[model samples]
Target: MTLLIRFLRLILGTGVFVLVFGGVELTQPETSTRWAVLGGTLGVLLLLHVWSSPRRGTADDPHPARMSDGKPQSGRAKRQGARPSELAAALAACRSAFASVALFSGVLNVLMLAGSLYMLEVYDRVLPSRSVPTLIGLSVLVAILYAGQGVLDFIRGRILVRIGGALDEALGARVYSSVLKLPLKVGRNGDSMQPVRDLDSVRAFLSGTGPTALFDLPWLPLYLAIIFMFHVLLGLTALVGAIVLVLLTVYAERLTRKPVTSGTQAGIVRNGLTTTGNRNAEVIAALGMGGRMAKRWEEANRDYLAEQRSVSDIAGGFGAVSKVLRMLLQSAMLGVGAWLVIEQQATAGIIITASILSGRALAPVDLVIANWKGFLTARQGWQRLTKVLTVVPADAEPMAMPAPSRHIFMQGVSIAAPGTQRLLVQDASFALEAGHAVGIIGQSGSGKSTLVRALVGAWLPAAGRVRLDGADLDQWSPEDRGRFVGYLPQDVELFAGTVAENIARFEPDADPALVIAAAKTAGAHDLIVGFRDGYETQIGELGEAVSAGQRQRIALARALYRDPFLVVLDEPNSNLDAEGEQALFQAIVSVRQRGGIVALVAHRPSALGTVDFILAMNQGRVQAFGLKDEVLAKLFPRPQPAVAAMPRLRLATEEPAPPLGAAAAGE
Candidate 1:
């Protein structure tokens, strides 16, 4: 199959090359050669359509997945072949659409000759014969052809738009998945939204006139070939103009690449700042730091605008030059054609036809120059998206595993912060069976939160394994693992949705009963019911409509939803009052009672009252892990007393002999 495809490609490519070069020969009469060229062009387009069309595998082709070398592929190799990178897969999916677009472009370009041909007929045929009916028939035929051109052009545009939509449909989810995973792999860089914007840019460019300009560019050679049939001098003049415009397009690309790239970077920075500011609007406003923040944003915006202006100036300048040069070259074609006419080398009709053909040949170049900025943006977006998708490949779905109802185990688990080499938790090993709850205690900056993050699969271990029921955590897909693990980070954030949706983790088909159950377990049922809309109350972004403690309670409810097997909460009670703290204690106890394991990181002693065990950590290392009271005893041992030598020690320390005179002098 591979050999057959290559052979066909070679044959079609050779035919196209031959037709293109052979069309340049002007020895044949214009009428015969034009018909031949037109026929050959259509044939070439048909061949191209055949060559570019996607081939599907069939049952009869047992070795359809074989390599180009004709070897049977291994299972792994077959899998890899079947699963291409996200971007490549998306483009491959659009192959049929693109081929259709190409065919439409060819037809449109052919119809573009209607105007030149009409002028030629009016000047050479109709005027010389003085036939009104012939002219009328010619006009009607040209009108029909023009109408067909318009229809094809509209269809091409629609196809391009759908192609953009198709690409987005195929890759949008994968790109969003990459966006979600990027922060975990690279830490929060404040530019997480750039990948999404890049994808939008590519889609927008595809839907716009930029791609139409690109499609029309390939037909420039065909136009020049037609002009060559008019006269040799006219052909050379048009070719020279095409070459000059091509050079200008290249120069424009070179000149604007840097500015476009810089502008994109600056825009990302400015947007990042805006997002950050908006997220922390309350802090900025309360601290009276709005002016400073605005100043910073203004600086970033100014840089972005400057770079954008530079890109615009380059594209605009080159576009103007290309337009003027095309006009000049068209006039030059007419002047040259007139000279040929004066020399009796060509007819007068040839002058107007050649002039029109030359202008048509250069139109794509001018359009490209005009849309150069968008082209650059789309190209750069493609490059960036490729990098991002490559860096974070799609997650492989693992075999289904049973729900974890046993112990959670960590074996020599050393964890480093994402995107950094420094280990935050070193060689941490522990285990907790069902019906067990462990409280992690440590000083500030210790590895408690980091360890909990790893336990809940928010971060992977640098070296070692986190297992549930003897199976590695990675053996389960994210969705499956999430079903077995619940995590509440130190900073609680809720999405913009109804209260019930947030409590249900935004599950489209979530059970209302389970949502209420989880909320009740978190002791937030009454609080929610007190709201005007109760469970259906709308929550603003980041749960800004709710108090901090309320957000924490809702997050806890989310974590508790569906009653995951392993629950890890970091600083869960930091914002909870005494009542909220009591509710947290009850929630932990409930998890234990239900045979679920829990790992709670807390600084407050009250938060640990219900835990069965304690894991003490210090300076990125586990200090102790045992029964709660035993570990606490080791961490804070009772102070020893010096009972026998107390009198002598007191006598040496007491300097009460400074009498009244010394007291008066001091006074």
Candidate 2:
């Protein structure tokens, strides 16, 4: 539509131009006027094409598609908002810069002909006439042409720099968001920014002469044709050399393909391990396990280096061969031209010119062989970015149902960690209504965290369904679901920001009153106030400045910021002291009393004090589930009366009833 509008606007302007300027021309010439006007118009249109080609850049589109929601989207949905046009727009300035470079390159290549032409003129014209004036004039003109080439070269380089910066600005944030959103359970490589580094490789190649070499390649035939114009024998010889070099380029690539692939894979693994290991520096040093870890990383690193070195060796050999072949080709062309001249078929001037042009013709091919590694890296990076960014989940529109009341129903919702086939939660089913407090009791690794993740739509269930308020959880858009659902993960991480900022979930313009309320509700208000700046106190990344208990409280406060209708807590009190635990217990019960469903994953019995019902999980399957007491009894079973002791007071003891209030309370 934009292009159509632009074309229409151009046509309208042209009509106006005809009305304004054609009054005399139309009357004067039936033959030449229109053509003359068209000639001028063609030049104008070409200028416009160069000037306004890309539509807009960061300056104009204050709202680019790749730059998503004001707040961090945190996951794959970060890529959801990115439209193809946005990426193109982000690169528009760079592409326009390249286009200009291409234009200058054309002029530069033409100027390259100045040296050849000057040589020809010296042998064919200046020397024959013995005209020093003509020689001086030619020298001045050649010097000007060389200077022009140098200027164009400098300008093109500046354009590429601008392009690189623009591309980085456009894509960096999206890449960061996508990385953060990626499921934690993804493969080892997932945690590393290999793709991001791949982006860097792409930008580095683009900023270099790789692009210029590509642009120069197509003009090879032009140089070769000029050689043919001089003498058929010289041209044919040069053409054969060119073909041989082309074949050699292909052969080198083929020979080096396996090593490149192996090296890249090994490098990703090595980098991933190194990044993961470094983040645990304290642990590695304290445990004294650095030696073993270093050995493992060294093995991977060694494989990568070996493969890369092998590729480099092969490529280096091919490069040397190309250089030698090029020199031989130049010498061979000169010899062929000399032979032609001896036969009185060519001139001395033609020999040198042909030799030079032949070298020029082979330059791009040599360049390809020389920079093959960077080219391959850029190619892989491009492919990786395309594959990753093209991925998008089905855009499910949010259900317009009444605000969720936290009636959750789970049926056979099996789950497996991302990038793994083993099931973490197998056919787990449960149902809970609003105003209910449910506890999930499980041993370590018994799928508590995995289940909640699936429940919150972070990772999909491998089978069956999870429903909220009678609608499939997948039916609701993440944004819509997020408005009412809150989750506190097992590993609580607070973003680097002020206490109030964390409590408000980093929502800009967060109401002070609401922030205070949330903090108070989670028992975090007093703790935050104890800091130097109260709500304004800045927290370090991952809340490293605070105690573990404080971090959990802050995270819990973040969860309750909006008074969500449903809350899922995966061992929320794991880092909390007894006081904090009591606060968490009260918060869960209070939320339940207010018609919010709370699913608390508990390991300690004390934390389950107020749960209305309990689900006991063992071996990824639900062992028992019911009223808290009923489930516990089934998990433990009834102790049988001893038959030998049945004779005396044992029978009376068996008949004796426990205290009614305490037994019924199930506390």
Candidate 3:
């Protein structure tokens, strides 16, 4: 638009100059003057047509797509917004966009300069020609020069439009890829929606108005130089006009920027509400709290409206200033041109050409100043993005993985946070035969889950090494170790996809029959089939639509889908009702029957009734390890009743009930 508008003005100004000056030749009544007047008028009309022609930019619309439920889909619906690397990636894209525009601008200015020189030659030499052939030839050469300038201008405009889109794609892909690599902890941190909002801001900065503004920065000086070379006075006038306009724009922007800042703050508050709204959407709907949420939304809307008004007010001021400046500059340029003509210092054609070039020179600068807000916005966003690249991941020494096996050993094992002596679990020494089922029982926060995490290599033991089949776990490759062990954390997370997809997460190519079999064994087959699409039905984010028991079943199915050698379930029975708990017990039995090792953390003895061995934890220490009855007796000493005297079982008497809650929240 900028390029086209300036070029049109160049055409109109040139034609007006020739038409007005050619009238002077008619008054002279000389044959030479009459021929010059007719020749110049024809040349000016050709230039006008060439300059005024349309120069359209690339016009592809934005259509961002994202992957969901392991399937590609289109929308702005992104998971866990941009990561730290994503921000840096956006800046890199912006830098590339800027460079491309600079190149285009250079090409444009060179062609424009060539056109100016050609016009200067025609005015000084060709207009004086008496021969018709000479006039015709000169006119043809000028037409070719204008045509070349027209083509260059068209290309420049197209490049700007296309570059923005290319930059957007590059930035989006990098940010999305970075988000995939971001540590789960950081991506899942904050109010659960922080990642989405932050990433969106980064995306807007890199792919929005900001990159376009950056691209214009290089064109400002190039255009300014083109005008300055025409005539020093005209160049100085345009430069001064630019300075004054810029100052006025800045004042206007400052007024607008404050409201935008307030709007951004209000946006943050609205985002917070939206996040909270999503988290409690169910409760809100069920409890009929629509009125309350609506009221909050109304407040946010009101605040946004006020900010909008402030922005509009400032924009109005800028518009008024722009119109006044345009009028003033136009008056000044004509006045100067008329003065120069009267003084016999310059020809009418030179004065006219300078006037046309002046507007073109100042055009890009106006654009740059108008878009200054975008640059600042992108900069702020860029800094935030840079911070992501510097975020500290959890410190862990890289070590070779152990040999692949289900057998796990903990020799003098202890797990503790850094800079603290408070061991969550300590002095835990145990060994399990390949394919053996071991049950862990303890009070709340007695390191039951911690022990499971250490066993699965999520966290390394602070004081001891874990061994797999006599090889140190640290000696094995992470991938190799992972292949041998499957971990199911306490709170199960499911992607918004089919039951089959969730179950086959580790193996996208796994047979659907196998997935169903695994789901059946996990006790989720019946419930999944009840959905409208059965295994193909969509599950909302985190499986919010499903019951906690169903989520656990799906998670179990997922763990089993890969048929890992060792399955570690922490508090598997926490969310399950009686039937679900029984199903879990049966699932454990089935695993053991199949010669697979199963490890579980449970607080209730009844929950571990199907397990072969029990490991009791107390205050970060292993109190006992043996068969269930033997370990239970040691952990909670009591008199044995007649019914509890069986070798495989024991009844409690004169013993307090376990104080710990029945839960084993795992990682």
The per-prediction CA RMSD against the true structure, in angstroms, equals: 8.0, 10.8, 12.9
**Stronger candidate by lDDT (1 vs 3):** 1
Better of 2 and 3 by lDDT: 2
Supply the global lDDT for candidate 1.
Answer: 0.82
lDDT of candidate 1 over 1-667, digit per residue (tens): 3454345345444433433444334122543355346546646665765666444221112222345775334344456766445565566555556766777688678767867877876787678878786577557556655665675677677777877876787678889999999988888775779999999999999889988888899999889988887787889999999999999999999999999999999998999899999989989999999999999999999999999999988888898898889889988998999999999998888899889988888888888898889889999999999998988888898899899998988989999988999999999999889999999999998899899888888888899899999998888999888887888999999999999999888888999999999999999999999999999999998899999999999999999999999999999999999999989999999999999999999898888888989999999999999999999998899999766754534566677667889889999
Give one digit per residue, the lDDT tens place, for model 2 in 1-667.
3454345335434433542354234332421343234334433543554465444222222222233333222123344644353344455434445665666566556557658866876786668778786677557545644664575577567666656665776677766655655544363452267768777887888778777888888878878887887888888999999999999988988898889878888888888888878777879999999999999999998999999999999999999999999999999998998999999998898899889989988998998888988888877877776655554322546656666785899999899877689998999999998998889998888877888898888888889899988888867777778868889999888888888888887787989999988888888888888998899988887788888899999899888888888899999988999889878988887788889988889988898897989988888988877899899887878999776645444564475667899789986
Instruction: Pick the winner on TM-score between candidates 1 and 2.
Output: 1
Report the lDDT of model 3 for residue 11.
57
TM for every model, in the order presented, reads 0.87, 0.80, 0.66
- Global lDDT of model 2: 0.75
- Judging by TM-score, tell me the better candidate of 2 and 3: 2
- The CA root-mean-square deviation of candidate 3, after full C-alpha superposition on the true structure, stands at 12.9
> Evaluated with lDDT, which candidate comes out highest?
1
- Where model 3 places Cα greater than 4 Å from the true spot, the runs are 1-100, 110-174, 177-183, 187-230, 244-269, 287-327, 347-352, 392-403, 409-433, 443-483, 525-534, 544-548, 593-595, 613-627, 640-667
Measured by TM-score, the strongest candidate is 1
